[model samples]
Target: MKNWFVALGGVLGYFALIFLYTLGAYLLVRSPPWFRYLFGFSSLSIFFGLLARTFHWASVAHIVLAESILIGGGTLFSLFWAFFSKKRPDPGGGAQRSPEERPGKSDSPATFLPAEGGDEEADLPVSRVREEIGTLLDAGLSVLVYGPTGSGKTSGVLMECLRERQAGDAERSILLISCSDGMEDYDLLNRPVPASPQEKARTLRAMAREHPDVRIGSLSRLFGDWDRAEGPLRSAFRRAAGGERLTIVFDELNRSSVSALNLILKVMDPVLGHYELFDFTTGERLSCPLDRLVFCATCNMGEGYGQTRELDWSLLDRFPGVVFMDYDARLEKQMLMDLGVPPDLAGRMVHVALALREAHRTGNLAAPLSTRHLKNWGRLVADGADPENIAPCLWVNRLVSHDRLGFPDKDQVHGIREVLGRTFRGGRKS
Candidate 1:
């Protein structure tokens, strides 16, 4: 009988904890007055019943009745709270308050913008791509990712870094900057630039709260108004290192002119490992204490895009490692499928894209199909448009016409057909 009572007590205690936790959640969710009252009454009943049973003040029948009432009442109250609670008014008229308006806002770490689909743990379809990146990072080698638009290159890098950041490596920082000249002064240091300044500031504050050490800044801002000859670039490098591991990514490095290459030289120079240059604005220069700094740059290969005056050997020699991001039909198909494209359609699309690329590469067609063109074509096809009926002219217009392989009067359609034939033949053999 003693052991039975103890076991009963344990079960009751567990239920009590559950009820209290539910009540706490209800209070947080701002349950309605009636619902709150119901919980209060149920809690009172349970407490008295438990006390009465322990003291033998009531019969077993009385204890059973009290528990039934408490459970029934609590269930009804919780249901009512879930279905009928009225939302509270915005504490400060919904006109958009700053992060400072909320109490203890800074105490909580900043939350990242959830992954693209709001699922933090969903695996990316490009496992091979992820594997390659993991290898580079593990080897302590910087990686330069190159892919056409919509290839998820930027998202992949950011997502991987985010996972690493969450793994408790607090001293590391990952910085991403756009190659655009006008993006200076934007607080890209911590948060991405949302469509408006308010969003940008909110994100920055959130980032500051969560990852206070991870600094985001623009390339233009880093070099803006600083004399290249006076070593502004070197100063920025020291600040970035700051006695910890740093991963600096330059997105679309080729978009910037050859002038930007000079900045690259300063950051990559072996001598920079010894001492830092002082920034004129901040008046601080010190040796970078950290031994690990990874420099990665992304750019379009010199094939389709207009050449930004060839980088001299001095600059080229700095980046000894390069990862060629060639077009991968299988990878593309997998990516499309992950983005909700049907398997059959994705396979067909990838087939056509690769065929067109091969035709162009072998000089069998007047103009090779660039990744940009393939992406546009994929979008159109995914939208249920007939790929064959779409104007080839629309795509050709987007290509660098002056640099096109055989534009204006070449047999472009024939080239596309020949590539399709070869792709189909290969498929049949398989």
Candidate 2:
């Protein structure tokens, strides 16, 4: 017990030595600022020595090897601490954007909103999908915004719609729905989570009879039982009086269940004049009144990722308009700038993003660079994260390999460092 106490005292003495040395470093090394770095180096050297002895290092050769390990270990530890703990000039990262900075806020040439002279009746386009839905929205048509995952298809569209909702009438609103499950199937019929097809259909018909103009907000109540009807029925009178039109956003359409697909088919039934559902309890039919709903679905068109399935041409054509949503480097950079990334840094990062996308296209990369990655990478850089470490922390470690055998492609993984070097340092920095 006495020996143990003496050992602990020695350990404390060693730490005290490091602390004193670090304090000296902080006072003396001002040019490059090697304070905590010196502490890390000394601390790691001590650790390496202890580790070597624990492995029974006693011979001169083993002791020499341990000393060599300590020097290399110390250098690595010092450099790592220096990079990880690096501070930025402004912790906020960049200048905040004023209203004048927004694309539509000025008439100056710097303004980069869509060139003027749009149709008087047309709503502004959020993305390419706007070309179809923006012009023909009032025609009661539904649309599918198809694209690669994490491309901002749904988020961008929803943001614009929400913006419109703020200015538009109470009658025009967008609802974000989780249709990955067969939500429409169960909810449309007014059945519980596991109700049979007939029970749901029957309740839907009863609810349909009373509701003249179907409003989107009351959709939840439409699927539950009210004892008098199959599902909870909102006052049809209120819906008619509101005269509200709905735009439904079905997120992750590719992951939707079979039942959801069936409900979608019913929505596409133009001959019915409204979206209708089958009811078994009453042997009657339920339908959304007036057919005033607009549907917008976001999906990944390609296979080999997630639970994506190929849409049949017949079902696909039911969606008269489709748009491919992909990454826009300019918009992404602007978003990063908005999120507090300095302009030059944002541009460099975006350059890397475009380069990565190109690499993915030309088969140099295993996975495509998505907006999500760009945003995360930008934020990390803004917070003073070293791109060398941040790159792997954000994605490399988290990604599943192409073959699912192990790590992602070696060349692709190596390219991340090369990309970061060019992007962050303007070129390789020592």
Local accuracy of candidate 1 as per-residue lDDT tens digits, 256-319? 5444555455546656345343343345444564345666666665554654344466765666
Q: Enumerate clash totals for all models, in the order shown.
A: 3, 5
User: Can you give the TM-score per candidate against the true fold?
Assistant: 0.47, 0.55
Residue 196: error of model 2 in Å?
A: 21
The alpha-carbon lDDT assigned to residue 35 of candidate 2 equals 48
State the TM-score for model 1: 0.47
Off by over 4 Å in 1: 1-132, 145-171, 180-245, 270-283, 365-373, 391-407, 417-430
- Model 2: colliding residue pairs: 190-223, 201-278, 201-279, 202-279, 224-232
Lowest summed lDDT window (length 10), candidate 2: 105-114
* Per-candidate local distance difference test: 0.53, 0.59
lDDT of 1: 0.53
Off by over 4 Å in 2: 1-133, 138-140, 158-162, 181-184, 191-243, 279-284, 288-291, 398-405, 427-430
Clashing pairs in 1: 110-209, 110-210, 189-216
